[model samples]
Target: MTKGNLAIVLHAHLPYVRSEEPGSLEEDWFFQALVECYLPLLETLEEASTAKDQTPKITIGLSPTLLSLLEDQVLKNRFEEWVSIRLELLNKLETNCTAAALDLKGHLKRQLKSWKSCKGDLIGRFKKLQTLEIIDILTCAATHGYLPLLRENPEAVRAQLKTAVREHQRLFTNAPLGIWLPECAYYEGLDDLMSESGLRYAVLDGHGLLNADPRPRYGLYAPICTRRGVAFFGRDSESTLPVWSARDGYPGNPNYREFHRDLGWDLSIENLKKIGIKEKRPLGIKLFKISSQNTSLEDKQEYDPQAAKESVEKDAESYLKDRKKQLIKLEKSMKIEPLLIAPFDAELFGHWWFEGPKFLSHLFIKAKREGVKLITLKDALQLTPQIQLCNPSPSSWGQGGFHNYWLDKSNAWIVHEWSKAGREMVSICSGGLIEESNIKIIKQAGRELLLSQSSDWSFILKAETTTELARERINLHLKRFWILINAIKDNKNITEKIIDEIEKEDCIFPLISPIDWKKKI
Candidate 1:
């Protein structure tokens, strides 16, 4: 069996967005990502799955939070409607086009057809890709937990892993073999919990390998295993930068779509005042494109979809060339074909880089034809089983590459409350923790507490890109934790008030048990 030896890891995640309103404005953020990123990615994988020359084997991690969103019936229905709205816009543009805008009309038609075929229904498409063996989808923390911070107690970390793995099994109908540590935040002993939870491998920041105590012999090009026998793939900065670094990456391409110049906020008020008879809201239906750098709306040109597709192909080729060089350098030093691990936030594909999905498809085709290997992360880890027994120090892929991103001056307040709450829960539970033989209520609250303490939400809040939303999520979980913890402390019976509130919040991963978690301690 020949292994092509290169692996790609795409981590897809979003904070829980179960809004009360039917058409929450914030929901657009996810709907757009689905249309632009997730569905297109599924399409690319589906096509590649049956390609004669090469069948691609990619590794994808969908956080449990993302899975909940995908499975959401309400969100699913709204997404169908959202896609329909775009289709209608395309129709309006087509009929309204003049002879002078024939090219623009044609471009809109092609985009409309693609959107029609997808219909924003990615769950089915992804399942098809999985069945075709084009990709291996893994699961992460229930809420993309920042686990290292929860390490003070073994049970807290274990509960997060147990709940996440079980949720993955339920969704995929297969136990997840790999895990994606949130933001690749990992510490030395994290593998113990992962291994216990039946996870085979997990990823870490590039520095995790470089900073390994005994030092990783294969460097960033290959995976290292812990004493517990769990594999760890270190992030490769060389390949990651060209796509992640805004100052230098492909998203900044002059020819590609501009994210900041969205018609939603850029269009004239008069043009968007009323979209339809039933719709009291303006949908930003107008279409426009970037004519030149620093060009105002008056100077903007019509959007060209075909030209953008061509640019996707060109950029894809450039990326492969860079990867070839990277692989060559690694093989020279290690004398072994080391795998180049390029893990990215999947949302970056279509949401941030509108042409990213096309670029990825083109990349797989170009690499396979050129004899560049694209393998799954699981297969790569299994290649070299002999690993040094060592633990990685606490670290994250955040700005400071440490907990400071969530605990520092900018976000100190979040931690003060979080730590206080977490410690209080532990102290309360430890005394009579699981004393009752059938204490189902205490167990339920324990799961809620663990989910709420997840560090991802806090870090995202500190970043302030979507601070309020992040705050609400944290508060939601914290509120549930407080209610459940209060019931346990007061020896009061758990009421529907507890379950209803949690269910209403519509949080995923509601299956974890606190008693099972306590055993890990």
Candidate 2:
């Protein structure tokens, strides 16, 4: 048997961003993710799974909103066009570069070729992996609603949980046994709802387990069961730091591609427009490396793809060696088998850090050779026969390790709107509005309310990266919700034009009932 078990969990999520107009900036979030993150990650895993590769175990959380976006035909088609245009953009730069950009240009050509090979079917590839048991797929809250903040509105919490499970079933045709709570945030009493949703396990930060009621005897090395019987796995920070940390992580290496310095930002709007990309946005063509820290964007050196590729192999081997050493030390110190749970945002791989997907592929190969067993959280529990029951403290992986990221002065007003919307929505559906003539508008109203409750808007508000758009999203949904509620209550006509528009834009949860909001407990 291996000395210890290592569970690598990747949480893939993005708030629903659909657009009817051409060239909306927010729409690029989905397309960029598809071309960069989702497609490459899927291809890497497919290649890894082709033979009897028992070492490539993983658990991935697919939030309902992201799953819906991946399954949408419109987005799929747009992704094909987006990558095609960018490939043309790269073709122009291949010969015109200042010798500094040759490697960057060649790198993009290879990436686009891989994208073409994928043919834009990321979700189906993910499903195929699940069927083969190569990876375990986990569910997340509907719209990724921040659950701790919504605890007061239990019905809203239940709705998020219920809707997520339902959607997961609809997609994979099997209920998920694990979940990645939005933000890895956990508060007391959430497990009860998970039990109801049929989720057997979830992952949280280390402090969540360290501060548990019984003070877990094995600490982060083992799983803990809540009073509600749901299993909670705590993330291992030591295992996570090498990849996620900016100061010390692989992403900050001078050889890796820099995330922020995109050529799109340097190009003229007129030049960009001529290329069919009208918006002055990230064209997913970054041409430089981190180079040297304290170096400005203009001062950075050109990226050499060959060097970065070599670094990926070395880094993956170093990471595997370190984890094996740590696991051995931990197992000896504890006098028992230790489990290392490393969970990270899936976007970090190919989207933020260009070599990320390749790093993962190499890690699996290196771990297998070094005898470091790769396992999922479910597999960990099966090995450890005894689990201690405990109550975790209220915590998150956010900036202060609390709810402050979603509740600070910048976004505090969102909590009030969310609570009010929940109360009002419950009143409408439970008050007999579900009768024959008006259920359509009421259901649409619930969709708006649910979308507004998304944790992404509040996060964007606090980050201030796109505040106006975030504010507009809140306003748009709240206004539409009230319009439907008032019309139905006053026995007035619900406008078809309004219904038609929102259904086109914010259409998620094709089967959500407004009554999911009525639970008082």
Candidate 3:
């Protein structure tokens, strides 16, 4: 008998990293995520759908920026070439790691076949799954902007939500009822804005609900509803930690493939350049197993695909067993049915944890046998007649359970830049007559401004990984924003070529409106 519900929310997002250069780091980021994470995830879900006893259901949040990237024809074509090149490189592997290389090559070949079967239409495939009720899709903030930080200019926050809704509708043909707030970050009044945008629900860190105005009667097991009518689900730490923590989770198992040790870093730079790579960086060709947590990369043993497969199956069984026990205990003590919300970054599944996708597939198969009900967030809402009403606390999923991670010394500088650009955007959209000729310029400026507000930049700065690229992206957007805003302010006769050039590079949110930044009365 089913004891309780388990809602697994995977928030999928990537910064707008489109690049014209084939071997650019930005391009590599998108391609690697496509090959290692997204494609594998889709394949896993597709495979799980074939099971007759249980239907796999989960919540996946696709940010507007990532949706745009997925729909881009240029990126789609490049992904095929990217896979071909990797396959070629894998075949040329003449080393002690040949077995591992061959294993990865086979996986890639299957993924490539899957890509072909879908005609490289990942977005359509995901949409079809949603149509089949296998998954509930959520929209994220436009460009994955940190909503709480943008709250200084309320209109800025509104623009982010509105643009996301519009873009999601354009692609998915309906407004999203829920959102995976960027970083699972929430502030005191964010629900009002979400309600205004017609969003009905969102997921927040456990504390956001735990520390509510009046403590929830059922705590994190049940969702809380704000006066504004938006429902907020809190993350269940018990359900998340075992999968999210590398040190303590199933992902750290010694049999799993080691993510950090890759063939890209091992190959000579001269040889890499021969394949069009200009520098030494991860090329997503990992072949080492985490023999031990303490083992150095060089000392790691060669990955055995068979051993990793066994580990995934074993770990999935253990995870479901734990959930079953927890749910049964909670059902006995709780007044209402218990819900364990396990929210994670979607990329973690297949990218960071090599066997992540297979693990999920295993979860679906074992969940039925284990008597643990796996349902989507949308389905969880219906479990209770009415949600507990409370004002959630200001919180984020970042370290310290607050905004400090994104607002710390490393990234605090960018906040002012975001605020300044936001205010200017509002001024331009509010004050202007919006000539037919300049509407294009104003819309482009709005795109640039929104791009600058991406939380990824602040995240990168704080993490100190790819800081230079983060800084460059933030400045690039701000610089272009100022140029476009100035042209509108000065009423300069800007050439069509100039505007065309800017649009060609950072083109996203084709349906974005400049008026979204207009100050609310």
Candidate 4:
């Protein structure tokens, strides 16, 4: 077994947001991340693939919903169109700009060139990484369900896992060895569902394992196996804060690119809002400069790429030093060299923090030299199976260190409504149905119920982080539940119509096997 383990797990997910009509900005959230986080990360991994020293063995969880969207013909075609538009803009910037502003034009030209270089075959890069064994990608619940709260029916929770397993199979040609519970929200005895789904291990919030009934011996530094034979790795909070914290983290560094102020909003929204009659809205890679707040657009100075690279190197050092200290402390005290698990939302890399991909690339390069072994949760568990049997308490990596963030008074209404609907659906499905096809309808309703119960959607809305879209998403799924439930209750036999409408509007996780969900538990 390796002495000490350092694993980084990134959870990539977003609620199903798509439109049938073409040329929609609503889909840009996915497009932007593909351009910023996903494609860049894949590119970095591919670049490091040949380097013997750059053993960047990463593990990331793509929610089933996200996997489905990635494979969508509609989204793929739309993405191609968006990329083509950007390429044309790049051409205009290069050819039309006057020689007087050569420096500004040159800067814009380079940024656009980078975007153009990474256009087609982006998805192939990820597939290539998996083929190269540089990354071990995992799958989460179909819509990232907060399963602990869904304990009213264990069968419903099982269905969520089953859907994820099937979706993973459909995408990658293999079932995921590890499962990422939505929000790391877990309750005791949830191991049964995980084991049934054939997951070897999963991640938990620090205190979930720390505050277990019989406290974990190695605390958050080691893995815990349940009686069900599933393994659990508690997140290393000590290691996570260095990257996650705003006040003290790398993101707060002054030299890094500013995220808060965007020309998208600051520039005249009037011109950008007009469609057919106006000139195209420049894609923010522009003639304008990047400046901090309180500075007018006219007073802005040029962006410095050199300065940004220097900042990345410094943050990489700070990150390495902290990890070394933590490793040393664990090695001395735990006797068995501890594993440091750092997990974050994948969007953190290039979406919110523009320079974050560079930070990660530098950090990986440094960690390889500094002796940080990046392993997957499955690799850690296989090498060192837990001797101690520990059951984690119910928890989430949210405010108050529990479920309050997703289940507060503001969001409790959602849970109450969904749980009641789930119970009714479960009872209806379990009470013998006449036709086999009717049984399929009941199970389909159950799947929709499970999707609607995703706690992340509600929390995102209530937090006002991305309030408008989050609100719309929660309502959209909730209505699906309402429609499905009413149709089943009324015995209205329009299953094909209902399914067709859902398939057309939001075609995520198309591997929705009603049979897998309806299997007698």
TM-score of each: 0.86, 0.95, 0.98, 0.87
Residue-level error in angstroms, candidate 3, position 207:
0.3
Ranking by lDDT: 3, 2, 4, 1
Which lDDT tens digits does candidate 2 get at residues 1-521? 45898899999999988876555686689888876788778878888887565368899999999998887777766665666676677768744464436654555566566656656556677889988777899999988999999887788888898888888988889988889999989988888888988988999998989988989988899899987889999989999999998668888889988888887897899988887667677877887889977899988777777889999999999888899998988887776688999999999999998899999999777777887999877778788787887898788989888899999999999889888888877777666666677878888888888788889999999998989999998889899898888888888886788788878888788878666776543
Query: Which candidate leads in TM-score?
Result: 3
Q: Candidate 4's residue-wise lDDT over 1-521, tens digit each? A: 23587889988887666667554545666776776677666667777777776667778888877766666777776765565554444455443454323433454344345545755444455666777777778888777888877777777787789888988887678888898888888887788888988887888889888898689888888888788987777888777887786556776565555554443444465644542113232242433324445556556554555666788788877877778777877788885668899998888887666667777787667776776777777677767743578777888887887777777666677777766776676666566552565654555565567667776677876686766666666677767766766776777757587677874676555566554434375
Candidate 3, TM-score vs. the true structure? 0.98
After TM-score superposition, what is the CA distance of residue 326 in candidate 4 from its true location, in Å?
Answer: 2.0
Compared with the true structure, all predictions reach lDDT values of 0.69, 0.84, 0.91, 0.70
Name the 10 consecutive residues with the lowest summed lDDT in model 2. Answer: 95-104
RMSD to the hidden true structure, all candidates: 4.0, 2.0, 1.1, 4.1
Better-scoring candidate (TM-score), 1 or 2: 2
Q: C-alpha displacement of 458 in model 3, angstroms?
A: 0.9
List where candidate 3 sits over 4 angstroms from the true fold: none
For candidate 3, lDDT tens digit of each residue in 1-521?
A: 66689999999999999987777898888888888899999988988888797659999999999988888888887888888989998878785356788888888888889889988899999999999989999999998998888999998999999999999999889899999899989987888889999999999999999999899998999999989999999999999999999999999999999999988899999999999999899999998999999999999999888999998999999999899999989999887889999999999999999899999999988898899888998988877788878999999999999999899999999889988988888887787667888889999999999999999999999999999999999999999999998998888888889899999999899998987888766
Weakest 10 consecutive residues of candidate 4 by summed lDDT: 275-284
Mind giving the per-residue lDDT tens digits that candidate 1 earns over 5-88? 667789988766656565465566567666667766776787776777655778899888788787776776666566565555
After superposition on all CA atoms, how large is the RMSD of candidate 1? Answer: 4.0
Q: For model 2, what is the C-alpha lDDT against the true structure? A: 0.84
Q: After superposition, how far is residue 395 of candidate 2 from its true place, in Å?
A: 0.8
